[model samples]
Target: MKTMRFTPPGYGGRRRDPEQVKRDGWREQGILAVSVDDERLTWPERELVRQLGDRLYGPRAADDGGRHG
Candidate 1:
């Protein structure tokens, strides 16, 4: 036999997309947290972010420092 669990409202424990969260924060509250070129990330990490950004949100502008952000 299996037991059912009760989940509370707004507490479903759903994992959010970090990238979307960052974008939302920037768009809704003008908060630019953890950019692709924040200098804190390594080259590979930056490149991964850049690639994901490009794939998800299209390519970045040419004047945006080669889409490093």
Candidate 2:
């Protein structure tokens, strides 16, 4: 006689990356892409996206055309 053993699904599998998980969730919801200038995002969210963009890529032109007071 042979013994059969089964392990639970995803019990010993590699952990999924958090970023990938977020991307997957977005894909599932039909969110193909998001822009920093998207009006759907709140002011704070847009600011965060702008900061991330600066860190990942480089500084971008100010929306006010460099006018600061």
Number of the top-ranking candidate, with TM-score as the measure? 2
- The CA lDDT of each predicted structure is 0.79, 0.76
What is the total number of backbone clashes in candidate 1? 0
Runs in model 1 lying further than 4 Å from the true structure? 1-33, 63-69
Instruction: Please name the candidate that would achieve the greatest lDDT relative to the true structure.
Output: 1
Q: Which digits, one per residue and each the tens of the lDDT, describe model 1 over residues 3-64? A: 65887777778777998898899999997666777687999988888888888788778636
Tell me how candidate 1 scores on lDDT: 0.79
**Residue-wise C-alpha lDDT for candidate 2, range 1-69, written one tens digit per residue:** 976476688677688887577688787986444578889889999999888888877877665468775
Q: How many clashes does the backbone of model 2 have?
A: 0
The local distance difference test score of model 2 is 0.76
Give the TM-score of each candidate: 0.42, 0.44
